[model samples]
Target: MSSNTIIEVKNLNLTKGRKKILDIEYFSLEEGEAVALIGPNGAGKSTFMQVLMLLQRPTGGELFFKGDRVDWKKPIAYRRRMAMVFQEPLLLDTTVYHNVASGLKLRGFKVDTIPARVNEWLGRLGISHLAGRQARYLSGGESQRVSLARALVLEPEVLFLDEPFVALDVPTRAALTAELARILRDTRITSVFVTHDYSEVPLLAETVTVLEQGRIIQQASPREIMTRPTSRTVASLVGVENMIPGKVVGTQDGVVFVQAGPHRIKSIAAVPVGTNVLILLRPEDIRIFKGVSRHGDNSFGGKVSELLPHNYLYKAVIDCGFPLIAFVNPEQVMGGEVLADNEITVQFSPDKVHLIGQYD
Candidate 1:
């Protein structure tokens, strides 16, 4: 643990009856750092966050705050220093202003100081006009803004967000995410975010931790996680479309050649010859040509098996000995007149192909 680490947990375990919900061996959060916990629905992401916030106690573990041991049984003081926002707003049946001020009152803030803090956060959240409106009468986005104001008014050292935007409409979610991103950046509050949406990770967190079956699978920066997933499961989670199981057939000058499916795929990843591996190719990294091109270096011929429109780009599946997915721009499609069942060329660089060694 570093001197900057604000929170740390060791040997954390949560068991209910015969099933284990969380078995995290170790985890820590540095002061002023934001980390996102993401995985599938039953991946224990929420459970781990709850344990950190002391909402759910682990069966066995030690929790530390600022290098001091925290007593999970009596965590009132610790809890007061942290604030949490849930998926649902869960506001009280009162006016928005009061809802935002309630936490301050409960924490024993002076009556005169509460209004300035509450109103400041309400304004920052762009909901100052709704301060007098009843919480039950506010829209989903409005209610969430009030909830955020309530949490921010406390000026807690750490914040916990549990999929706070999961229930909002796309436009509302995007706007709120933008606002929250700015607030988090400006304040630099240490935080733990539990979310399933990959789109929100880069905007809100500097680091991501992938949890599965109560175990930490991988933890890294968002760019690293998406581009170089450590496992097939992580590749799938981060939207890696082409995961080709292959073997290292040759190596020369730092390039490893893998015979996957019917093509010799070259990659920069270092793996000894004769070892089996999974070749990961993201859809965005592959480029499509209207017809066959003799580019030759990591280029191959393929027939377009499927072409689907996605907003402004076309998602195409090509069978170049091996099936590969690529996102094509409309201009590229029109120039090449590409469509399903048409012969097209697929091209990618060796550095773009990531490899994960398969044991056994």
Candidate 2:
């Protein structure tokens, strides 16, 4: 480990009964960086977090912290430098203040400093008024906030959060994410967050590790993961709406020209000629125009098949020879003419398209 490296796991493997839960060859976390671990259900994300937090022992491989090998027998000392918040908040049947102060008390902090620390964290999480409230009576969001305050009040150097915002509504989740980002930025805590929500990736993660079937399939920055996924599974996980099966017709200057039926799509990504590929297009990357004007590299005529509202955005399903989805601002939907089954032109830039291997 280097000075910048906070935690490193080498060739980690874990088995439960007869099944292998995780098989991570190498993973590392850097100081003051936030990494998101994303995957489908039962993808071993939680198991990996447990290994990092020292709550579970790996069947193979070694873990290091700050260049020193972790001693399983002395897990307590290492745990003090890290904290975790589970999917559900586990609060005692006491007051919120006590729940937030329990960890510090167990560490034998001075009596005078405990209240100040607890109050500070409560305020930081925007739950100062709930200090006197009974933990059992708190709402789902409140309890989660209390759990966050409890873990953060310890001032740990590393934080492991497993879907901390899963239980909250959209607005509350957004608010908490913003607050957590600010706190982590100010404290410079190295953090690993596991989530299934792709929309939250851009808000919280600096880098993202995509896990599939108990193995890491891809690791990259959130933008890279969204725009240049390495595989079809990764492309689907990142919410790419249009993943058309195509054949690589030509390759030049590292660009792959793919032919999907009669459509020719140009991608900046490389793929060998004559090989099968999948062209990924994000819904937001498509532009809808009322007229057949040339604005992008690819243009197709389509008819609106379905219209649905998603919060402040409208999801329009268009039948452009192939079914395609586009996300536009709600204001745009309202300001433009009605999209009902009318012929329209959809255009998307070539750079916005990504190509991934077509693995059956």
Candidate 3:
């Protein structure tokens, strides 16, 4: 553990009747470090946050803050040290200024200094002009800004963001994310963010903890988590489109060769020869062309079984012994021949295909 550790949870578990809600063994957050906690619905993401924020008492084990054991009886004191922003903008029926200063007033800030703190935070959040506007009249983006200003004006020791941008539109969400990133960088506050959006992890956190079925599965940096997930379950979460089962044939020239689905492909994994492995190929890594292209380190022929539009790109599923999804852009798709049931080729470099642990 680092000397700068601010929050630690040891063997924490939450059970209700015969069901387990959260079964975290051990977790720690360093001072001024921001981390993203991500999981699907009912994966204990919110439940675990409640435990850390002292909103929900754990059924077993203990929680520590700054090396001191948390006292359950003193909820108010601990709560005052941390602030939480939920998905919905839970603002009052008053003006933006009042909503931002409400928490300060309840926390017993001096009346004389309330205006200064509120105005400063509103300006910082880019909502100073909207301070006099009523909460009900504000747009979704403005309401969220008010909510953020309300949270930051308190200068709490910890900040918890629970899907704070889920309700905003695309452009608005992007703007809010940039603004939040700036605030986090400037304040260097200890924060724990929870969101189902994996892409948002890189903006706010260096570390990401993934949960599944109430169990803490993996903890690593966003890049590491995306490039090399620990398990097949985690690979799926990180957008691994192709998980081909393969058998290690031999090793040569720092590359381990594997026989997968009637084809031999090379990978950069260090697994021993004769072992079984899973080749994780993301759609973005595979290039699809109408005709066979033997240019890549690994190439295979597959029928273009499906073509689905994914925003600006097309998701094409090719049947090359097994289903292989390749990201086809406007330039990659054949000229005016973008249709299913056509013959195509999928090619990927040996280094592009990530190999995880051996498959059972």
Winning candidate number (TM-score): 1
Residue-by-residue lDDT tens digits, candidate 1, 1-360: 899998999999999999999998999999889999988879999989999998888999899988989887798989999999999999999999999999999999999998889889989998889988999999999999998999988998899999999999989999999999999999998989998788898999999999989999999999999999998778888889898889999999999999988889889977999999988999998877767876757888899999899867999988887778899889877876678899888889898999997642
Candidate 2 residue lDDT tens string, 317-343: 988777889986766577674266766
Q: What is the model-wide C-alpha lDDT for candidate 2?
A: 0.87
lDDT (Cα, tens digit) per residue for candidate 3, span 105-196: 99999999999999999999989999899999999999999999999999988999999999899899989998998899999988999987
Model 1 scores worst on lDDT over the 10 consecutive residues at: 288-297
- Please name the candidate that would achieve the greatest lDDT relative to the true structure: 1
Candidate 1: segments with Cα more than 4 A from true spot: 334-336
What shift in Å separates residue 213 of candidate 3 from its native position after superposition?
Answer: 2.0
TM-score of each: 0.96, 0.93, 0.95
For model 1, what is the error of residue 232's alpha carbon versus the real structure, in angstroms, after optimal superposition? Answer: 1.2
Model 3: weakest 10-residue lDDT segment is 330-339
Alpha carbon lDDT of each predicted model: 0.90, 0.87, 0.88
Candidate ranking (lDDT, best to worst): 1, 3, 2
